[model samples]
Target: MSEEFPIQPKFGPFLRLFLHSQLFCTPQLPTQSFADQTVIITGANVGLGLEAARHFYRLNCARLIIAVRTVSKGQTAKEDILQTVKHRNEADAIEVWDLDLTSTASTVAFAERVNKELPRVDVLVQNAGINSKTYAVSEGIEQTMQVNVSNTFLLALLLLPKLTETAKSAKSLPHLTIVTSEAHHLAKFPQINTPDIFESLNDEKFYNGQSSYEISKLMQILFVREFVSRINAKNPPSPSVIVNLVNPGLCFSTLATRNEKPLAARIIGSIIYKIIGRTTEVGSRTLVLGASAGPTSHGEYMSDGQNQDVESWIYTDVGIRAQKKVFEQTMKVLESRKPGLGYAVGL
Candidate 1:
């Protein structure tokens, strides 16, 4: 693999990925049932997120919330999941909630609803994300950066208290999993010296959708590192909330080609996906594993149902500086949305 993108299957990483993907047996199912547990999955209208919802429902989770941008689409997903359930009574266990990751206001509204409505949240799967071929802006920010990095963690921070409370009351660790991507290894850590890293990312002169998407994934990983550090540094140390990042690898889903407008690009993507991509069912297993993982998985980067090591570059001096910069900028943006929010979360 290229030195900058070491996670690609081009060198020793290729062999590791090959063994993990092709040689491994089915992922180990969760030994413990989700009985009476509440699970929330974003982007559950389709793809891996929808498949994860099915798996959680089958595990008999007491309350399953499918959060999506479109209520109708989420309802359709809930109905589809219900079709596979063994009993009709289980239909009531699933509810569709509205969430638009493009808007900070929408994310905060969703978080408020969750805090007010849900009694507890045992597992939170931050699975919603987007990639676009052309430049687009949402809420005055680049679409990919807004959805994948800003709003994604905005929702997570807003719900941290609930996760902590649930874990403390139940005497069990609650999981907060953010679905990341191997593409993160490609990030160049642009604008490291800028005060507003995200604003720099939004500048059109340096824009490339693919690179922007990769950088957003990198930001997610960095956020996880910073978030876990802050949680550990709390006065009493909040061990109850276990946050993790997971990469499902390339999967045969619309997520890969949804933004490719050119017919040629779409055709080539489809062929590549057919040849190497895992099914959505298999890809979703990684998300489920991350959600059900234990304390050992805290702040870890998991892939192929295991806590694998991240790229060595993440530990380099330059990488650490970039991570700290991104983390500080991310907190500033989030706290700007709600004053004192970072302090409230112990950031």
Candidate 2:
């Protein structure tokens, strides 16, 4: 199975991408019952993740696990979500679990715990992410790349077994929703040509004036494409899980207002957000839609609750080659962290 999407006309596509900023109806789901599914949403303490979790609860998801770096904050968000959501049963459950994305040990531990305890992982939403303004390293990799690119996909790979297990036993297509963003369109990814993209990104000079976060997001897009291909190539009678990347459009994000950036840029961003940015609740519906989106949406990029094409260049041979490199290197790093992960995950 080739991972390449048909390239669209570069000039024609943007005019159609209304983004969440200009206008979009609140995504409404028909009354659906997730009365027996276990849904896990990371970064559920605040922002889009929190809102997405609330929507799943509203849909009557039987067991919800709100994974957060801070348990206290997760508890607060859990309470807020539980307040008005109608329940399926008094025995229905929502629990706050600890998951620190910044640490490899923590991420592995979280997934291990999930595999051990969770009866099923009906949907795994990879919502937790970071936008680091200054240069920093975690686990010897640049901090932003460490969490967003390396660890994020690591957790995804580690959890694949349980997800596939849920699929087989439940006879349901489990969802693995990885959060991406429109900011990837801004990523030139100048370091992609380097002998080692991840290593080049570690140089403080490369990140000094460059958009490290945006580049990381581009890596995410590439990673998903290649990952879907490898899994589908396994030649199962049918896919056990649906995996896709989602762009929530430009949400009114505090990360947009980081202090290290230019003053004029921040001012302009604040103005734009006021004029057009989406609220976390409105933005989060994409996550909900992505998780529920069926077979056709597998490996697609979802925007505004529908399958949307990515940047036109991504379908080109150059882009296809880059996609392979990113996923290969990402898998290399992840495997170094946890030997044999790629084969073990059926990738």
Candidate 3:
């Protein structure tokens, strides 16, 4: 039987719960024996994305594409996975592709490649995202917003056709899993505004550190809920595909720390993390759960491998309402942009 926690966690330190809980038995989860399914995992070079890829590979999923920004690093990750999984052949299983979600051009190129070559993509995990030390701009938008929100939005839109096609052909189902964060619980709401814009590259105000990180995470959840609603409205009962969001419980893996402070500062942080963070294996469990076939709540947020039936009073309604508005705005932005791009910028 699947495990259940009697004590639901609070939003601020949900990662703490994620790090500390053994929410489910990995061995008992569904296997890839289901008809060959193709899954695309972003940010697969390391951290949660890499771990998630390994999970899919073990299930013997048809084709697991590692869509990463660093193509070379991605290749190395592919090698590592092959080595880690016993008796696994390199071909007919895992592949790598270049995808820098921060750039509209790159997002487009990646989508085009997938649309042209792959027959059907069963899962598109929007796992690639970033946070910078100082403020920066990507594709003319705030760096965090661009990578975490806009680019993600664009990629989801571009991949919709393939997702739709796969949903129709397979007769089973397709899913879009987004790697969101518990930090979203802190966001005042999901409405995108001028203040929400990253002021400038290296803007210290934005980088006081924790605040910016939390804000980006908040946007991520909003994006997930927003996308789900749109998919339902546009596609209807055929539903074809479903979108779900997850906050991989805080394991001590680098989300944006790869670009963080001085070596000493990073080391100190790592030490602190060692004291609190979960292993990569533990942190990625919920993400893997989100991607798998299950009863995923449409237009809802999930944490610790299960849906949060009752949210904190402060966040309960705002999170939902804000996500709805943000979804509408995101569609308008995507609808207005030129076709053939993975992400559209300029607000």
* Residue-by-residue lDDT tens digits, candidate 1, 1-347: 22322322134674566446644545565446778799999999999999999889988889999999999999999988988766545778999999999998899999999999999999999999997768989877899999999899999989988998898676468899999988776666545556677788889898898888888898899878877876787646447788999888788776885764678877888787777678888889899888888888998999887887766677776556667778888888888888888876776
Scored against the true structure, residue 255 in model 1 reaches a CA lDDT of: 82
Listed in order, each prediction's TM-score against the native is 0.92, 0.90, 0.81
Task: Name the regions of candidate 2 deviating beyond 4 angstroms.
Answer: 1-21, 24-26, 29-31, 86-92, 208-210, 257-266
Candidate numbers sorted by TM-score from highest down: 1, 2, 3
Model 3 ranges with Cα > 4 A deviation: 1-35, 188-209, 233-238, 262-268, 309-317, 339-347
lDDT of 3 by residue, 96-152 (tens): 999997788898799889989999998888888775666666656667777877778
Kindly list the per-residue Cα lDDT of model 2 for residues 1-347, writing each as its tens digit.
43333322344345446543347545555245566899999988898899898888888787899999999999898888877565533334889899998899999999999989998899999999888778898988899998899999999989988988898877468999999987777677777777788899999875752388878888999989888877787766367789999888778854555446687887887887887787888888889989888888898898877888887788878778889989998888999989999888776
Per-model lDDT: 0.83, 0.82, 0.68
lDDT of 1: 0.83
Of the candidates numbered 2 and 3, which has the greater lDDT value? 2
